[model samples]
Target: MTTFTDLNLCPELITTLKDLGYKQPTPVQAQAIPLVLAGHDLIAEAQTGTGKTASFALPMIDRLSRTPVEGEYHEIRGLILTPTRELAAQVGEHTLEYGRLLGMRVISIFGGVRFDNQIRKMKRGADILVATPGRLLDMLVQKKLSLAHLEMLVFDEADRMLDLGFIGEIRQLLAYMPEQRQTLLFSATLNDSVEVLADKLLREPKRVAIAARNSASQQVKQSVYAVDNGDKADVLSFLIHGGNWRQTLVFTRTKKRADQLTAELLEEGISAVAIHGDRTQRERTAALAAFTAGEVRVLVATDVAARGLDIDALPQVVNYDLPNQPEAYVHRIGRTGRAGQQGRAISLVAPDERRFLQDISALIGKPLQLQPVPILENGKLIEGGKLPEKKRNQSGKTRKGGANTKAASKAAKRAPLQPEEPVAPDTPGKRPSLFGR
Candidate 1:
């Protein structure tokens, strides 16, 4: 029953939280805010949507606001490093929202945009700076900013930073900042690499774990459909169309796959867009805005591009391509089922991806039962049979096909849907009927 007021947050932040309609402190915020306010280096493991941003942002703002700056020029007292531009933007927005009443100045800088604007903003000064490691390092090398007076350092989504191979950049950035600052590392999961980073960055850190490490949210109902790799797009399309889903987030392992899936969905008369690393900041922002506003029916994104998406009440998420890193599965599905709302997480598993599925299941400590694919029959949707098993060679290894062969290339270009036999009626109390009738 603890509230933001009980957390001992400053009155300005408490009022801001009230105006934002946040009635209570989430587990992470309730536990980590006090330590942050007290100037303790912290390592917090909380899943996405658990208010981790506010946990650090509120206290950091309160601490910074205690002594107001004398002039229009504000020194960067707090630095938050995120893995992706989207994340940096998100954290920056939240920090601004929480600190606005206190006259705090916050700036977010990342790549894929004009550097001069960021430089100008930095010259104006920021009490708190949110940045991606690469852009932050670039600014340092260009002498656009200084962290010499930094009082707090935060690595938001620290695990994701490592996953995106930002560890070296992070280390390099650290060398530019003061070593006496209070460091805070917030990650969804604490693996060995994250543990090492925490060890190196934090000094006698206070630890807070609001959820089990590497676990998917219990509010998300997870299901997997076994199909051939070539049939993934059709299956995803079927689910979206049949279920009449207005909003869905789909994840692919590669940027190429994301684009391909988006094209296929668009061809199916579904409004779809692809977001990935190659896209400019403007393009990514537009795509996300369209998706959030429900102008886009499906948003196909690679894992890296989808990192800081904060969609409210997202009903469905599909794993168009399972991630090789099992921890990423948790992050992908975490996009949905946020704030205790029910959500559906569907995965299209091909024969070659069974190992990935197994790894994901093991990491999440639960078995993901494969379900029958849904198919169209007489223009009605029905459950289809399980996928056929892969043939084995004399060596007992699964036989492989040449994916680049002319026949394979021709098959890839064919219409995404293929004929399938209807197996059984839609079971009651499972997923809702696909027909949306």
Candidate 2:
């Protein structure tokens, strides 16, 4: 049987991995590390929690540990571009943790934080730079950081990065990088766009794709619950507090809904907070830390900001609102059942979400059996109660953008905004967050 020992990683990386309690390499990591170590460009289609960070990080560290350091500037040897700031921080941590034994200096750059601090850090140079496209581009434009020395360029979560509209920024960063450098792109699914990006960036790259569609990790058992809009919160509260679920990540469709739900959950005496693009970077970081440290029991978030985020031991994930895009369903549920641990995913589907549910089922290539929403005898949610399928708002009339007639204006004043993708079907693959979330 193959082991980390058999992978023949550098001793420095091996020591750090052992200290981090990694007994063996995951399939993606085992196959990927060797290829990366050989300075080969790669496109690894692996799920979020497959330890891909270490897969690429170990190789970067092995190659950079003995690099010819010049004066004080560490000369960035590797650049890892991630979509969200949270993911940027995560990949940065993994690089530092694994590369520390070899004296590799790791830096994480992302927007929302002040630029002066990042500029100051940039003056000293980073050995391994993990960044979100926005800040990296900002720094690049400011002439504070140069990619001249970058040896490895990685677009971690390539599809998510592109969906989030980081493609142009990625191209900008690429423009500055040495063309001869090795490139690596990793995502759960590889669509045509990712293939095109890889083709343009890599040099006859070795491909290692993992067919874990509708799956990030097998530990997450997925189920759906049909409910009315009014019962969604009641059902959620029951599952979290009633079911004794200490930690559950609930995904909402909008930032407003996230804030509203978090507030409601707190009123019910359940610890919860909302994380979204509207939040200051500090608030998002604090909320995530609180959740990680068990200070907060629930993290309610919007899909736009939470994709590609890695939360450890995530036992349960609840979709308070179904995502408009079917592909987002996989990303949301992928949060739970990670790294060989059992996890549960419960999605709440309203009458308006029927098509969304069906589309998700088709995307994953499996039918999702939806049960009824669990409610208390008084039409409330009871502890350990699993409700059978029930339709809410028999007519899912959301005041969508109908022609602006006088009667329409009157209806709009009274109707709530309809839930649907802001983008047209023609531009489906455009920016995932159009409003610059």
Candidate 3:
């Protein structure tokens, strides 16, 4: 029964929430907002769709607005670092929305775009800055901005930042900011790496855990289809066609795999697009936009590229390939079943991926039941039996590498996702398009 008004947020935020049709604070918001407004460093563990952004943004805006900075040029008072460009853009959008009535200026900076416009925006001044670490560091080195006046620092998706190997960059960025600022770390899961970072950065932080650790959303009905690696494409096509899925997010482990899957889906007469690190910003943005607007039926993405995707009412998420890390499985399925909407998460597990599936199950503290793969033939849907056991050497043990290592190697070399021109360190701003348009 806790409401935004009861949480002691300012009237401007309350009005904005009402305008956005948000009646009550979500669990994380209700808990973390108060702590943030009270000027406490916090470590909040909440699921992706649990309003984690608002929990920090609303309170940060309120606190900053109460104490206006005295200067003709607005200095960056708040900084939020995200793992990927997509996430930075999404968080920037949300922050702008939440603080609009208060007249807060928010800007997002990431690589893959030219720096001229971003520098111009920074010169105009931003009250809150959302940026990916690499681009932000570039700006700092170039003397385009300063974080010395920052009053608050937030690490959104902290676990993801570490997963993307941004720890060193994060540390380097910290050296540029004032040490006295209030720091808030929000993540879906808090593993040991995150714990170490939190210990180093926060001072007697308040911990808010909105859900069980590494747990997938209950709203997501998770199931697995056991199949051979070679038959995965056919099974996926059968499922999509048989179920008549309109909007689906598919996760692949590698950029190469994402591209291959997307191509295969298109060849099957299914609308699909691939997004990954190798893609240019313009391409990534367009692909995401098309998928969001339902112009594309499926979006195939690697784990890094899909980190911060926010799709409303996404009905289905297909794990085209099981992730190497079990925690990523939770984050992948999280793309669907968001904001209390019922969703389905289906994983096509090859025999080699059974171990990966088991790791995922263990992390989530629940056993994922394996379902027989479905076959579509003559316009009929039928069970296709369990997956065959992994191939073993004559010694009766699973092969050390894989059965078709040579073939896999050849495929990887032949069809690698074409990498875009590298973003030159000095001219990062010249790239086309920002993420999350």
Q: Any runs in candidate 3 off by more than 4 Å, and if so which? A: 375-437
Put down candidate 2 lDDT per residue, 133-244, tens digits, no spaces: 8888888897888889788888888887777767667666777888888888888788777777877888989988765654435677786776566556655765665467
Model 1: residue 119 alpha-carbon error in angstroms: 0.5
**Which 10 successive residues of model 3 have the least lDDT summed?**
392-401
Highest lDDT among the candidates is held by which one?
3
User: How are the candidates ranked when ordered by lDDT, highest leading?
Assistant: 3, 1, 2
* lDDT, model 3: 0.82
Model 2 earns a TM-score of 0.87
Worst 10 residues of 1 by lDDT: 392-401
Which residue pairs come into collision in candidate 2? 228-392, 371-389, 372-387, 372-388, 372-389, 373-387, 374-387, 375-380, 376-380, 376-381
Compose the digit string of candidate 3's lDDT tens values, residues 310-408. Answer: 899999999988886799899999988888899989997766677888999999999996765544445554443444355311111112323222222
Better of 1 and 2 by lDDT: 1
Separate clash counts for every candidate = 0, 10, 5
TM-score against truth, every candidate: 0.88, 0.87, 0.87
Report the lDDT tens digits of candidate 1 across residue range 1-437.
99888989888888999999999988898899999998999999999988889989899999999989998789999999998899899999989998999989999999999999889888778999999998999999988899999999999998888766676677678788988999999999998778888888899999999999889999998888765677576656666766778999998776767777788788778999999878899999999999999899999988888988988999989988788778889999999899989998988887677888999999999998665565444545454344335421011111132122223234335564432221111111233211222
